[model samples]
Target: MSASLTLVVLMAVMYGTGVYVMLERSLTRFLIGFVLVGNATNLLILIMSGPSGTAPLVTGTASDDRMVDPVPQVLMLTAIVINFGVTAFILALIYRTWWLAQLGDEGDTLSDEHADDTEAATEAVFNQVDLDDEAIQRVLDESNEHGDDSHTTRKGAGE
Candidate 1:
């Protein structure tokens, strides 16, 4: 079945922009990219469903060949629902990340205090994971006994 040139080009553009945006380090950009890609996928399904005809509702005058297929329309609705759920999940992630960073209304400004807090939080997580490994913990303990102050451990860690 033939598809519209305009639609194909628009889909291509959407896909390209979505991928580019998703590659960024920002979670908000990733959300926007995911939305763009999801809508483009719905458009793709619509295009593949063949040319539009009469409404899917049965009418005495319209034959089967003149009636539009409803499967793609239903699929698009389902895709929309899935996209909404995923969007909500991503929004929650953004909120949690912001909360963890504990930023104020400063807006995009990472002060030294905030940066150090974030770094310490990250290091704490990594150190906890490392401590769970027995061999790594032994090495850390041995290094500490030898007067090597490089490895920093959190208080009450591995307790």
Candidate 2:
């Protein structure tokens, strides 16, 4: 019916689409959702300002009836720039994720062989330290001796 009401409807539709797209797992859909949300927010701002009253600039013989509210327009400009930045960043992230996915390393959801390798590596790292191993014992001894020597040297230098 009214222009303000139409804008409100448009904003609601945009928000609904955004919410739906955000639920999707695909990165493209998520990006679209973010854009939709940004647009919806911008539209809401415009609608809340009501109809433009008159020219924003002051004139020598200006009437009070028609001065447009320039605040919403300024806000909309800033919001558009911010949205553009966010969209660009999202696209870059999507590109990086796609590149990684294509490189045969699909993160934690790997194939059987890769999963097995990952499990083995994780187990190896978490395994108990074997103090009985001759090499490990020797390394530990060396480190202790080095530490003692360093401490002695520092003490002597301080004195």
Best by lDDT: 1
Residue pair clashes in candidate 1:
none
Off by over 4 Å in 2: 1-3, 105-159
Worst 10 residues of 2 by lDDT: 102-111
Candidate 1 on 2-73: residue-level lDDT in tens?
998999999999999999999999999999999999999998998899978878987676386789899999
Q: Where does the lowest 10-residue lDDT sum fall in candidate 1?
A: 149-158
What are the per-residue Cα lDDT tens digits for candidate 2 across 48-155? 776767678778564755777788899999999999999999999999897456334423434565667665664454354443476688999999999999999999
Candidate RMSDs in order: 12.5, 10.3
For candidate 1, what is the lDDT? 0.83
